[model samples]
Target: MKSIYILTLLSFFVIVINLSSCDQSIDNLYTEKSRIQFKYFKEDTVTQGQATVYRRTYFDRTTLSFGMSDDEVQEDTAKIVVEFLGDVSNKDRTYRVRINPDSTTAKEGVHYKPFSSTQTFRAGRRKDTLSIVVLRKDLGTSFINPVDYRLTLDMEATEDFNLGMKDGLYTHLYMNNYLVKPKWWDGVGSLMFYHPKKWKILISFNEKWANKEKEPFNFNNGGREYFEALRNYLEREPTFDDETGARIYIDRLVEQNN
Candidate 1:
């Protein structure tokens, strides 16, 4: 009978220990740390030599090329979206971005404006954008080649939040001021060379394109006429090529495809 009583007490203590352990596991499961990451990615449709497939490609790096702008464009803004990965709160939260000088070639005040010491994530918001003002004026000879300036940004932990994913902890942005090729350059037919002086003149032909930012790069004119008209006009009234010292009106038809 005494042995039986001892076994009963021991079993009761064992059950209590298991229940306490289970409660701790439950508490740990409910607790989660807040996290934030950059929500930037590129998507592409692959249909060549295979089935049609849609894929999302995430990038921790991208180039901030300013080649498409007209001569008057001095400063451009880059919008980087940061995403919150936790439940929303009723109070605002702040985050920090540190620069890695070893990997950064762009000067803070010259190539790009410095980021604020802290950026705010408003209450009830799940996403916020970080604006980086990239300065292009007075670049001097630094922009003679492509990708002359690069800036690396890193995420830092703070009282309000913790770093999210390992892969999204940082990003790199490269900058250049050269009048590099635009995306729709091929749609210009086969007669133009992309010269800084010449591109400014070509874009002027369209009144709707006065605001280069709103300019619809598409060559469509409701089946009426558009890029071909620009070609015809240039062919008839050939401007002396100040860039090459040869009139492109005649030379382009035989020599250049900008």
Candidate 2:
């Protein structure tokens, strides 16, 4: 009788151990399945006359925590591409994107693409946040613009996944501030009307500078000299026609150097 009791106890312990192992395996599978989550954020509403800015940022829990290679992370990232378009109704609206391929590179890849969605403008009020998602394989080789009205998404995968499209993700990302111009040619002949507010122009004047051939033309010292020369030429000969103006500027620089 005691032997039978001991055998029964051993069987119960074995069963518990097997169940625990199975549970652990299941938990690991779940962790691997939903390895990453991408989220986007933007303003909810904007006044008709004012410009609306949208910002997007992404963070991955599994990718951040695990020491995964970039290729691996990219494999998971290819599932979706989120775009932000500024004005919905305007036909001239453009999209822009700055991509940092790796953590080490300071120079970001910039791209501008036309928005492809049909514009649908509301009469009196405007919805603040416009969001869309595309499958990774469908994103193709096109550069994604963060600000654009029409979004083109191609989702080939039949699997359904919940994506978090919230305004909080963009809270910390950098947004390009742009002015909304009523017309494209508002008497100012294709101007730099919409540029980042925080951009600073750096000039370099070193004749022997070797870094110009490399990525991110380093504007450390003496760079302002280049800008100064260009500014002086422009101010002195503001009315010079395009061909003559370029020639004069070049001649002046040659004379100055000689």
Candidate 3:
């Protein structure tokens, strides 16, 4: 009777261990499958004038199989979003794009073909992406460029059950630099240059912080004092030629520095 009891206890413990192991495996699989990333690249040469080109790429994949069958298949997709932030009124504001899939590529018993899209700008905030959806097999490209625009992308697995994992696997590509025309002196002086409407400038007089930092720092007191000083100076100053005005501006900066 004791032997029978011992055998029953051993069986129960083995069952519990196996169940725990399966649970852990499922958790790992979920973590591995849900992720999204974006990459940006610049394509421009110094000799090619001031034109700039930006590109973004996105990627995702998944596999599915029936528990009772040997048949299994995989699905993979890629999306690219490009954002253009600059003085939209001064630039050509158009884009050219191309997309092609490798027919010879296979992942986990699944094959894929590429599709692409390209177009010209119309009117908007310029936030859109080239989305390629591959099911059994479909391929194409598009060209998209519209005036005043930005770009962003959304990605997902084709399987319905994987829909919940969409957020974990989506990313947005970012461009850190803006294409601007060379700064030119206005006829009336006062440093005239067009910047993107979204850009902001913060002027400050904190020499200690400015000298120690490599990047532009925000005005410590909300820039109100800096603006006020400039307003007072202009109100008290006389009209002068462009060059003279510039000289006076430099002199004022030197005085502030001292």
Candidate 4:
């Protein structure tokens, strides 16, 4: 009977321990950690029964190059989207953003136009876009070669919304007017552009000067001057062509562009 009593007390203690552990597990399961962050993708709807997975498409700091070869008529701009990371609230949330020149290479009026310092996420809305336009005319002669001009956007904490992860706090934009080698430049070469021949010639000529010139040459810094010099060099046709011919076949076209 004493053994039975002892067993009963031990059973009760074990039951209490299990119940306490279960309670702690439940508390941890229900713990809500709400956060707000920037959403990289523009997907408006999540598929039915699909888990909500966040993919970071935007970078904390990224460089975006605008080639001088881009269509003159098309508007040039970049869009950044910010969103909530946790459960949505009943009321609309307004988030404030601050844009500042992160690097001296780019200026507000010269490389890009200023953006509004604030963005809003409606009560039911998941994300909002911040657009920054790149002025092509302003880009031509403003930046120094090889140096990247950067624009930074900082997420500000406000009563309506709180900042979330590290990525949500800041984003960067680096703009330049050089002929940017596309992401697939290695596989596809100059075929990515509409005018492949012109692109090839320009790329070929630039590569030549980059390899042989005493001073480093780049299409972004003094591209206007470099191309002008190339044209003149072709025209003069120094006897050195027979002695030290241009390495690239495109030099013939460069001399003929006149």
Q: Count the backbone clashes (under 3 Å) in each candidate.
A: 2, 12, 27, 1
Q: To one decimal, what is the Cα RMSD in angstroms of model 4 from the true structure? A: 11.7
- RMSD values for the candidates in order, in angstroms, are 7.6, 20.6, 22.4, 11.7
TM-score per prediction, in order, is 0.64, 0.24, 0.25, 0.53
As a whole number from 0 to 100, the lDDT of residue 87 in candidate 4 is: 67
Order by lDDT, highest first: 1, 4, 3, 2
Sequence-dependent TM-score of model 4: 0.53
Whole-model Cα lDDT of every candidate shown, in order: 0.68, 0.29, 0.33, 0.56
Candidate 4 regions with alpha-carbon error over 4 angstroms: 1-34, 40-58, 62-65, 68-71, 89-91, 100-104, 141-147, 187-258
- Model 2 is weakest, by summed lDDT over 10 consecutive residues, at 61-70
Q: Best candidate per lDDT, number?
A: 1
The superposed Cα distance between candidate 4 and the true structure at residue 206, in angstroms, equals 24
- How displaced is residue 130 in candidate 4, in Å? 1.2
Q: Is candidate 2 or candidate 3 better by lDDT?
A: 3
Better of 1 and 4 by lDDT: 1
For model 1, residues 146-255, the per-residue Cα lDDT tens digits are 45577888888778878887777788877776655555554545435554434555556655533333336444543125455555666776665434445555125243
Q: What pairs collide in candidate 1?
A: 192-258, 193-258
C-alpha root-mean-square deviation, candidate 1 = 7.6
Q: Highest TM-score: give the candidate number.
A: 1
